[model samples]
Target: MNSRGFSRRDLLKAASSGFGYLAFAGLSSMAAGAGSKASPLAPKAPHFPARARRVIFLCMNGAPSHVDTFDYKPELSTADGKTSNRPGRIPGAKLMGSPWKFRQHGQSGLWASELFPEVAAHADELCVIRSMHTDLPAHPEAYLMLHTGNSQFIRPSLGAWTLYGLGTESDDLPGFISIKPTGRNGGAQNYGSAFLPAACQATRIGSEGQPIADSQIGNIRNTKLDAAAQRLQLDLVQSMNHDLLKRERVNPGVEGVIESYELAFRMQGKLPGVMELAGESPATKHLYGLDDPTTADFGRQCLLARRFVEAGVRFVELTHGDWDQHRGLKAGHSRNARAVDRPIAGLLTDLRTRGLLDDTLVIWGGEFGRTPHGQNADGRDHNNKGFSLWLAGGGVKPGITHGQTDDLGYEAVEDPMHIHDLHATVIHLLGLDHERLTYRYAGRDMRLTDVKGVVHKAILA
Candidate 1:
């Protein structure tokens, strides 16, 4: 102030009068049917041609057993009930064969258990990675690794990176959405944007025990003001923000605030219709298993994911779990699979029929997988040494199995793909090079893969 020969008070007086006219102009523009100023979510071209326009992550929260589900190990069944002396073994752990039988399905001849009969029907569309390995055995660290790439440090999630690299295609909705996300094991941090702009963070739809339809952005509706009144108010706020931004020079947080306000204003007229399931046809509802009580909750979540992707949301994640079956493994896994199988199948089939699958990447897996050896008499413990996850569409080779586990399905025997590699591959599919897609933070460039990722090109179509 002293250098410029202008006091703070003087600046305030000038801003107050100048902003009044600016606010009025903004309001007039709104009245004239002009949209909000250039949105932060305005679609941007990817680094290169993108294979997938969107991604839908089916997060099976608890570690599902690979040996019992997709990785068929004949030796494990042949030597069932045998004692194991492998490293990291829980003292007297015994090798246990799957209670369910695996059968070859589809023209691709992919092996799947009876537990996932519905998903198996779509086996030809899947690119199952059998040798998935991660560093941690516990849920918290493993889940964090799966989402953020680094298990120990807090960092921007994969979704945040995707949003940061390529701005949202949807202005009315969030670029990244996590529906019915888990409340435990890192909680919101799983989708939090750590160093990236706050607006890049995921917009959570539902949480544990809450009906998905009940999910709404906080303070989305105003009781005191109608649409026109709200527009007037918002215009004034945006003018003040713009003035502050000019004075501040550069502030990510302030910029985030402006973007958030703009998005919320636009969402008022659009979000309600997008979230309403009543508008969906009876056939669509039945297809997603919304007619049945058991599958209704997950069915609704899956259907919403589809809707969000169709609405141009860049990334959508649907979480279902408590698949960590340490006791009553058979009963628990069966119940868990049954609840999601039909809905998952419905999602895939619907996407294919709607022609969304061609450009939408669909992923299915848990944080880690269960040990081949028994935990209790009948249950298995966590095993980060080997696991399985599957992908469909989005330029992946369909109906092919990539990599392999050992005879007992306890470790990745060949072409092991780590969590970092998975993240790299995902970004690659979205037309991003993980090595180059980085942000400057804390004096150095930070990336989702964190300097340790290699895209599995063999799986690419």
Candidate 2:
């Protein structure tokens, strides 16, 4: 209960008036009193000490195959071309051996396939989770589950929740950012703050050319009237809104407008530095594979992600789309892998070299993994039963593989981690109580993990 003896739900009722409520009611309340640091995303002393301060989520939109990439099963090699009559979607699917070869690397003897030789160099930095499972096999549903905790309902994204719970390290930028996300799979709803304030929603910065064009302050014709002009305009607006607030103190839309305008004005000057890769040398760009045609686009995105986090953005999401390889498996997977391989490795290497890896959590995986068996005699279908995901930096054990799958790589035989568990562990790394970092919505307090989540302590360093 709050000081008002009201539950969080009651507070939401009191505060959730559209823009008017947010601007006048909420901001006014916050502004009326000085010395109040009440942003939902403000960093707080964790329940326990935290090992990570920021997160970079590399979201592979299409599922990548665990059997082909990270999890190597010797039995698949021997049982190549054999048919399996399992109770799966395809009645009699032919056994498929990985087209690539896996070799043990580093001191940990972690096996990485030829597809990601760049990432393989950092094998010792990865904690591979082989037994990861989810509820759905389809992209829309599974992607939603992976991102928003719930498959059906709109809710605060984990990034938004993180910001709300922890607050911003730099008030200039949005705490959550999503790069080149897919529009179809859950769309903007994936990153929407839902019940959380609009401030916590991801600031969508598109591919080069347009960098926050809408939010920047308009150009002033008179340079001489700069500060005085802005102050005069601001004061005029505030006076009008203040009078309006007296009549309707609970309008969220009105309140939201005022808050949005204020933040946007403040962000105008700070945004350019945040977006620019200011001092990045040509050598650094080339190392990230930006010089190569095949890898350039993804490379730019990865490099930008690093730049954003360096500027103190709390959460950064890097997304590349259309990994759904139902046919032409070799061509599809190879193209997808080549596009991101070097850039990803460069990000890891750059972070480690800059000493950011110690406090920055890096996650790599898709909505799910591909089925070992072919869907149409060529490509694999989506498989949510079992898959592989990996984490590096931010207190994760390096050069380790946790859990295993069946001989055919169909089922998780050990240490299965649900998506909820992954969410919980992520929150744990950032010093949040997964269960307690919640927003009141629809009469219940909604959390990222909901009622299901256990921290994967075994993988923690």
Candidate 3:
């Protein structure tokens, strides 16, 4: 006691010791401000009725050559080893014809090359966009463009934008999850939440060259303390954080930290069950090509992606890499395709059989496509003027091809779809008007589709 009574400092100092419980209770209630919410990942309704509830992105990391895969150019084949003149061509660059054979398949009779025979079997389900183009030819810039819409600026990724527009359905797992992500090119910036809340960033599951089954969350289990003890510790920490928050102004970063802690605590109870593959049947395992060494790694990624989306994870990305074939195109593409072919087919088939296809959008593509012009003896150069990507499920029109590349597959001559347009179309399918889904940051209202983007209604069902 000072002069008349005990000082505030004395009370605080005492509370810091044995009287901590009293301080904890008081601070907790103050932090919660009336009726507080439990999680930031709680499900929220879309801006309008949505066709797709979740999205799975099969990122074929290095640019895949559209001329050899989906787009068939007979004129280029005719001009094979001789080239001399095409606008934008290096003066003496020669034309290169795809060595793979193109065939028509399914009731829709979609044109697909032998490079993706397994995927071609599901031609009726795919919506192939042959004239997909972006701004850059380089991997880093093109990758950033495809993921964040702007190649030069730091911006929130597509997954981050989706989470902001429509809150996630899963409370125990993170809304955005990236499996086997790469460290090259744009790196984490591809999935990073630039100006958005930190919680919106993707939780990386596995690294390149690491098997998904072998991946484990860091610091997930606490062997030192039991559940009850852990809870007590967490509550104490939360209370202290709340007291600090109350003493200072409201900080978004602080709020995000609190949410992350609460989420991590909740995930310990649920995430293990989802990650475990022991419960899956033998036939299912074989279907994912887990029994085969060549397909096993990518197969595991596909299967895990299915499980995640089925469990209500808003966005899940599976990456397959080294598709950039500047040399040894035939051998490289063949090897890369073999690694992912069966697994991709199995994923689509599984999703269809499980009836998840109606509400789940599956996207397959790379940063850009390869040029029709020859680089080394057999390989093609990078082409940003025209490429291809395909979408299946969700509300997309099945068994259809939209847009077209010119005779030589050099550029998008008909109905070219830019990266911004693709982003706009995706959000539109999810029932978000790209124009309205804006976040005020820095000075103006920023959006996924900056100032341009038109929804390609032709592809919608």
Candidate 4:
């Protein structure tokens, strides 16, 4: 396959420089978990006592309608067909009320529309932030901003930052796992490591709509080589990699490959069992709504997230769809809601029952919220001015709404929280002060929240 007629293995068969002995020693220790102390994925102490040991970010890719989902505004409902006189409002666009009814749920009685009845049942565990705002209304920009602190420039993602700071609890598994992510809008940028060590990047399991039933990690497996032969091959590859590093002096690429090979070696033994769900009870599958065809895809992601977190992964991200409905808001949002509602609720319940909820921060929201006003037709337009998201478990104050939009649900009017602040809070919950958790890159200190963001201490439990 190379320019040289012979393979490296074939060429190296006659050469010996103690490379085999050195690699075998390193891999043997690594397999026993003794070598992880020198690894970048080794567990590290937090900056402070962390409220959460892990994070699960439930990302709804397309903007979901805040007015229809979580931020129920009766005023917006009453003034359904009214045109806006507000500046910057689109011309002649009428306000559209949510097709579903809003009702109080759980002992907390947080207002949520009928679209998310399942999630509403866990209202007592939810800390709903009603007045969430972001930098842009556009999908690509806001989506990027929601994941990485900066939109215009490539930056480490939230998961990457978390993994970089905490270094994960497991050496056998990836620190960050992104499930069923969409390769659109922000694409890989949403989970990329950027200037951070490539080891901090997320290990994506599957794409958005693709069911990962037989979906194993795609490449690097040579069916012909057994575990021992593979290890020997990897030893040779790693020796070459280290040789490159010695020559180049500080090559992140080579360093990342070296680490990846070792991790892959260790993962081959554990990951297949983790991904297998045949052992899950029928009740467990039913709990996640996996029995239903409509909800199966997202349900699978949610369940895998739980398994991954339980297996000591530090951060897990599950993405579900283009919630962006510029037209047919009711039908589209309804379908989307039905798909994720039970699965999300099941995740909450499962975590709590397993005692994982106490330290597993669960976040649910999209890049932005759809506007109260219709976009020419019946659908809501993108509204970066205001939106909503909810946090549960971890250290968040439960069953309380901390902010609000105006009565018309047009924009955040009180206790408005920006995306930067949210990022700060997320990092804070994971025991890293966003300001202090910085990586030196390009002669500057880079952080998840950048120079912006103040943790919303009021929402802290």
Best TM-score among the predictions, by candidate number? 4
> Candidates' TM-scores?
0.91, 0.86, 0.92, 0.92
Model 2 per-residue lDDT tens digits across residues 1-461: 53335454544443333222112111111132122224444455776888888999999888998888999988888887778777755767777888889999999999989889999999999999999999989898999888888898888788878877777777556567787667877888778777777667776656322322222223312233343344344444544555565568555454445554454445556666665654789988887887898887788788888888888888999887567888887788888889889999999999998999989999999988887776777788888989999999998999999988888788788988999999999999998889888777789988999899999899999
TM-score, cand. 4:
0.92
TM-score for candidate 2, please give it.
0.86
lDDT of 3: 0.83
Off by over 4 Å in 1: 1-40
Tell how far residue 104 is off in model 4, in angstroms.
Answer: 0.8
lDDT of 1 by residue, 1-461 (tens): 42235455544544343322111000000111122244445566888898988899999999899998999988999878998888767677789999999999999999999999999999999999999999989999999999999889899888888888887877677788888889998988888888887778888887876877678666656656666555555555666677777778667776677777667777767777888888889999999999998899899999998898999888888898889999889999999998999999999999999999989999999999998888777799999999999999998999999999999999999999999999999999999989999889999999999889999999999
Report residue 145 deviation for candidate 2 (angstroms): 0.6
How much is the lDDT of residue 22 in candidate 4?
19
lDDT of 3 by residue, 26-72 (tens): 00001232233434455667788888889999999999999999999
Model 3 TM-score on a 0 to 1 scale: 0.92
lDDT, candidates in the order shown = 0.83, 0.76, 0.83, 0.83
Q: What is the lDDT of residue 306 in candidate 1?
A: 89
Compose the digit string of candidate 4's lDDT tens values, residues 1-461. Answer: 22334467653652333223212111111331222225566677999999999999999989899999899889887988998777888877788888899999888889999999899999999999998999888889999999998899999999989888888788678888888778988888999889887888888887876785645675435455566556556656666776677778687766666777777778778777888899999999999999999888888889999999999888899998879888888789999999999999999999999999999999999999988888747688889989999999999999999889998888999999999999999999989999899989989998988889989999999
Q: How many residue pairs clash in each candidate?
A: 0, 25, 0, 0
Report the C-alpha displacement of residue 274, candidate 1, in angstroms: 0.5
Return the clash pairs for model 4, or none. Answer: none
- Candidate 1 lands at a TM-score of 0.91
